[model samples]
Target chain A: MNSVVRYFTDIYKGVTSLWTGMKVTGKYFISPGEIVTEQYPENRATLKMEDRFKGEVIMPHDENNQHKCTGCGICEVNCPNGSIEIITKKVPNEQGKMVRAIDKHIYHLSMCTFCELCIKTCPFDAITWGQDFEHAVFDRTRLTRVLNRPGSSLKKKEVKS
Target chain B: MNEEAVKKVILKEDEDYIINMGPQHPSTHGVLRLEVCLNGETVKHMTPHIGYIHRGMEKMAEFNTYKQLIHLTDRMDYLSAHINNEAVCLAVENALEVEVPERVQYIRAILDELSRVASHHLWWSAFGMDLGALTTFFYGMRDREKVLAIFEESFGSRLLHSFNTPGGLMHDVHPNFRKHTREFVKYFRKKLPDYKNLLTDNIIFHNRTKGIGVMDKEMAINYGITGPSGRGSGFSCDVRKVAPYGVYDKVVFREILYPEGDSFARYKVRVDEMQESLNILEQLVDDMPEEGGYTAKMKPVIKLPEGEYFQRVEAARGEFGVFIVSKGEKYPYRIKFRSPSFSNLFVLGPLAKGGIIADLVAICGSLDLVIPDIDR
Candidate 1:
């Protein structure tokens, strides 16, 4: 008689547990506002990324077409994956002394882990993370970017030091 | 009972067969292949093959600086990325004898719990999908996105945020960090009961999980299993409780345990742990220090003394330990990661034996093995 009572108790507990589970789902099903999925592509225009988002590396050029990079190559050395390469050449300064100048600040987007080491290690604050994330390209060569703008030169103040 | 009769029986048993479950199957989570031997529907044995996604992280660590290696740890257990980064940072901090600020400790502890909730949410959804309850997948992902959004608001990456440096955080918490965390805590408290109603109390879930893949306390200890998987067997291996680090000692939370040692018990432990994590988060967020520095001052380049250092943290999955040997160099001489999934994966073979093949899936899901963590 005791065994029979225990068996029925177990069945009653199991059934109630399941019913409670269904109730939660049922509640969500009736509420259309509770749906959390976003419609991709359609919502692209309104989509916003955080201010601190690390999308890609870019060298910020001032209005005078001058950059902060000194071709010191600290970022190149600090990059764990060899993603940044600084091409430097000797240029005549205002004092007629030959000084190092950046020719090309090449950045390979494929190899970069976005660890922010390059930006953090830059003494001159030459490079920073750009907010643009749409970098999809058909060819692999397109992923390699020259950060220095065409006809741009190093900031004279930075070279004076 | 004669030798001839036994020989005939052996010949008839040759119908038993073998099958390979995955290197690509969704049920295996990541790239893990299980070689299973079966007699009709019942599983006789299982051999797991790992390393499909191994990127030689430990070997790669030798060539990178201590700061650069933090990024590599994130790839090991991608779900527990913050905790993995924390383990390495803690090891380095201890080696250098650096004291992090009070605010850093509080923020790190809060983020650790948030990552735990996110990871367990993913596991719960995947577990439900493994059992043919597809709706749970959508529900779990929907809730998980809230946590990811919080991560994105601060650290700027949803999955792999290398946000911790050796001394402290890479950056301070966002202005809205406290407000958003409070909102999430309030929001999730209302939703957690739904999780219990939807999965924990479901009769079909109970029928499938209860008494299946039973592992006792002795076997769990012998196998060196830690985290919720071991706690399910009543082994009491919560690293946070045993050896508290960060603000773990300061906060109040329970180490969830269940003695049944079955699939249901393992599932219950994680579900209960999610609540405990919420409790911890609430306490830390409410009493966070008003003002402090996010990072401590350090030399541009870090070099540890000539010795060995080991630090362990309770990751979302289990105990994650980092062993560093430094010969007073900028780069570690040798680094070895003690990942929890490797030991937990070994228990699958024992648990799955004598159970039906379907039960094998349930058992593997309960263990919640992250393959890259095992491979690392």
Candidate 2:
């Protein structure tokens, strides 16, 4: 008789706990305020984020598409993963003397770890963080981007000069 | 006849049976070996042997470039890949003197919370299975798949996603990241109560778990427990709120806690934590910064300035600490990863000494022992 009473009591307790837990879930399901889900993409017009969040990097350009990068190769040397490469050349100045200019700045997106060490090492204010994230491509070669263009036609260079 | 039956039931003295729970034991979670000394059903003493799954990540981090180590961090807590990546990225970002954009910080916080929820769900499912609740295994996996789908859509990889870099994120959030994460959290939130009802509220599970493998608050503190494991014993040590990294402090969320220091309490801690995680996700989806300069102007070839920096982040398991020593070079001199599972695994021997064999399994599951976290 004692064992039978103990068994029934244990069953009652088990059922009560289970019922209580289900009630909490049911409350969320039944009430409109309980369901705290927000639809994405459809509601992306209303999406938001904090101000100081980290994203992808970008090289800032001037009105004439003039980039400040001198191609000093500091970013390449500073990158731990060899994600940056720069080709430097000596161009003839007004005095017919050879002066250094960045010929090519190659950025391999695949290898980039985005540590941001290069931006700090840059003596010339060149690369900055970018916010464009939809860069998915089927071909890996597309990720390797050239940041510098041939010939310098810039008003900013005259200001600095 | 009664005396003869009693004699048959008596144990034969001096006879010992050894059952070795090898590194392959399913219930052991990772490659943890245990030599069980048993006299019939009662376990005399259990000798747990570890270090089978050691990847020597700390030692390896010394050779790999700081950038390369981020992927290795993913292997440490394979389930919480984003959290591990965040810890490593935060360390390198600090060392390089790079500031993350406000938008990326919020994204990291949201993803880390989602990872925590997914990890807890996996733990609950496996713990129930350890306790002989077979139905929970299917239910747990189904819920975990929802979280994984969100991870895939946002990070491009479900597990071991090396999505975070030193300065900030590898890429900005996919245009659909916020929408997918919110949807996943909603569905997962709806499904959690079923788990509670099926397992926690079940009579057999409660009777078997409650008061079994009780851990006092003092022992829990002295052992340096954190996350759900520490919360089970009332530690309330949540790094997200404590240090406020990656925009976690700016957001509103509460750390779930339980005063009881038993196996069931630990289970409750993780269960309630999933809900809190949902709460954080809800807020993140509602307040995602849509437009911003996501990544800072950190150079492509990053060299760490000479210095020692300690970075701490709350992983799904507990506090993950990374201490990096650099000599103003591309490679770091020393990288030490203070893993949460490594510390939590120590409590098992002390907790399991006098408990039943089944209770040992209970404590192991409650502790949420991830072998890679221990081995890392």
Candidate 3:
């Protein structure tokens, strides 16, 4: 008699459990407000990425077309994957002295891991993260960007004696 | 005898056949191939072939600096990327003997719990899909996206955020970090019951899972199966409780355990653990310091003293250990990662020996094996 009683109790528990599960799903199914999926490409026009998003590194050029980069090559040295490369050449300064100046600052977007190490280690505060993230390119060579513009020069600062 | 008779005779002689499940099957999760020898639908034995996704992470770690290596750890257990990053950071911090600030510790603990919850959410979705509950995939991902959004708000990247550095975090939390976390916690607390109702209470799920893949306590310990899987078998291997790191010692959360040692028990352990993680997050988030330094001051170049160091942290999957052998250089002499999924994958053969092919799937789902972590 006890065995039969236990059997019915077990069946009741199983049936109730399944019913409870269905009720939860049913609630969600009826209420479309709970739906969380975003329609991609449709919302692209208004989609906003966070300010902290590390999309790509870019050197900010001022009105004078001069940047803070002193061509120290710190960012190139700090990049783990050798993503950044700086080409330097000797240029005549105001005192007719030959000093190292950046010819070209090449950045390979494909090799970069968005680690922010380059920006963090840059003593000149030359490079900062750009907000634009749509970086898909048809040709692989397009990913390699020359950051410094033509005729751009390093910013002039008063030398301390 | 014709070809049919000959084949029948050959089959009769052995009475068993072999089959390959995947290096690419959807159910296998990530590139794990299993060779199963079967006797009339019953799995006799199984051999798991890993290393398909192995990128020689340890070998690569030897060439990279300690700080650079943190990015590579993100790829191993991508689900628990933050925790894996924390392990390397803790290991380096211990070697340097730099005391991490209290704010950093609390923040790390909170983020660790958030990562745990997100990982379990993905596992739950995938596990339900494995068991033929297709809607669970949608439900699980829906909830997981909320957590990932919170991660993106502060850490910038959603999945592989190498936010944790050697001494502390890469940057301080965002202004909305606390508000977003509080909102997620509140939202998830209500949705958690819905998860319980949908899967936990379902008789079909119970029928598929309960008493299917039983691993006893001794066997679990012997195989070094830590995390929820080991706790399901009644082995007390919660690293957070046994060897507390960061602010784990300050939090009050139960280490969920079950003696059943079956697939359902393992499933139950993870479900209960999600709640505990929420509790831990709540405690730390409420008491977090408003103003403090995010990272400790360190030398530009980090060179560990010549010695060996190992640090273990409870990742969502299991205990992830980072072993480093330093020779007082920027790069380590040798580095190895003791990934939990590798050890956990081995026990599948033993657990599925006498079970059917369907049972094998159930067992694998319960184990929650992340193939890259195994491969690494």
Candidate 4:
């Protein structure tokens, strides 16, 4: 008699658990507003990521192409993946004093872990982040981009008004 | 046989044969080995042999720079690497007195939740497979792959994203990450019921699991089972709810509870926890702050101040902790990791006794033992 009661109680609990779970499933399954899916490539334009999402390493340059990078090797030294390589060359200013410039800023995208250590190490806010996440290439050489602005590498200082 | 008659069999089948079931079995999850003494198909005693994957991470942490050690953490519990990274970063930041930007903190919270969801997805999928449901395995991978794609877009790594840093985040959030998360959450919200009807409501699976591996509230606490496993025993020991690290305190979410403390109950608890995580993710995506994403900055070599710092996060498994002792040098003095799987794996012996050997896999699955975590 006791075993029978135990058995029925177990059955009751199992039934309740199943019914409760199924009720939730049934409700969600049949709901009108329940359908939620987006086709990946089809919805490419609308593929949303958070505004402040961190994606890739970027070096920011001013409109005049004057960069904040001081040719400081801090970013290169701090990178865990050894992806950043900064080569400094000194150029003579109008005042005839030597001004250090970053000759070649090489970033190997393949080896880069994107841990952001380079950004953290930059005392100057020279390197900002970019969101160009889809950087795959048919050729591996496309990943190693030199850190130099196209038109103007570094603009010369104009006379004060 | 009746109780009196069963005494004869119990007495006669004394020295049961012991078969070791892991440190290698796919069902053991990571690297846990269970020594099971069985009388025919019935389990007499079960002891879990662990520490095979002990990387001496804590001791190694003491020697490596805080920044270098963060990478080391990515290996400890490889499933939820982001969460592991976040927990250690939180502790290091606390010690350094670095204030994370509001936006960064919020994003960390969001990513942590995403990690939780992903981890649970694998758990549910693997748990189902362990119990003989092969289709759930494919479904799990399909759903999991979507999140990994999103992760790759957001953090540039699939399995182990060391996105979180000591001071703050490496960079600001990607513009697409929020939208990606929103869509992912929406997608998972729909996929959940497909999960339910496929596995949860199955009468046969329920029969196999319901009464097996029962652990009440007291036994659960004593055994140090945590995360969903402990909660299945009615202990709401979520560090997010209790301690409120990162941005969890700012939001409202339910502490999912299952009072029965059985194998089925724990399994059900994880499924509910995933829903709860989705709910939190929805709220977080809707209201992610725009201010403060990066901390001030750190040295190039990533030096640390001298002191001991301990940080704990509510990982999908349980309390994932990192204890770092800095010698005020480039490298740490010591680093000790308290993984949830380690403590949770210790309970297998008591759970397996008197249960059928077939139920061994089921009970282990319910506990969600990720062996790398136990071994680490």
Q: Which candidate, 2 or 3, has the higher DockQ?
A: 3
**Candidate 4 Cα deviation (angstroms), residue B86:** 1.2
Instruction: Find the 10 residues in a row with the least total lDDT in model 2 chain A.
Output: A48-57
Q: After superposition, how far is residue A77 of candidate 4 from its true place, in Å?
A: 5.6
Mark the regions of model 3 whose C-alpha exceeds 4 Å error after superposition: A1-18, A158-161, B1-15
Alpha carbon lDDT at B87, candidate 4? 85
When sorted by DockQ, best at the front, the candidate numbers are 1, 3, 2, 4
- State the TM-score, rounded to 2 decimals, of chain A in model 2: 0.77
lDDT of 4 by residue, B1-376 (tens): 8977896654434466878897679898766778888888998878777788776767666655667667767877888888899888888778878777777778888888888888888988898899888767867877887788788776666887777777776556667888899999988887887788778887768888998998999998887788999999998789998888878888889998999999989988889988999899998888887665456576555666788888899988999888877778887777778899888877777888898988989988888877777766
How many residue pairs clash in model 4?
24
Candidate structures ordered by TM-score, highest first: 1, 3, 4, 2
Estimate every model's Cα lDDT from 0 to 1.
0.91, 0.78, 0.91, 0.79
TM-score of each: 0.94, 0.72, 0.93, 0.73
Candidate 1: residue B273 lDDT (0-100)? 94
Tell me the tens digit of each residue's lDDT in model 3 across B180-262: 89998999998998888889888889889999999999999999999999999999999999999988888788999999999
Order the candidates by lDDT, highest first. Answer: 1, 3, 4, 2
lDDT of 1 by residue, A48-143 (tens): 889888899999999999999899999999899999988999999989999889999999999999888899899999998888888999999999
TM-score of the candidate numbered 2?
0.72
* Higher-ranked by TM-score: 2 or 4: 4
Clashing pairs in 3: none
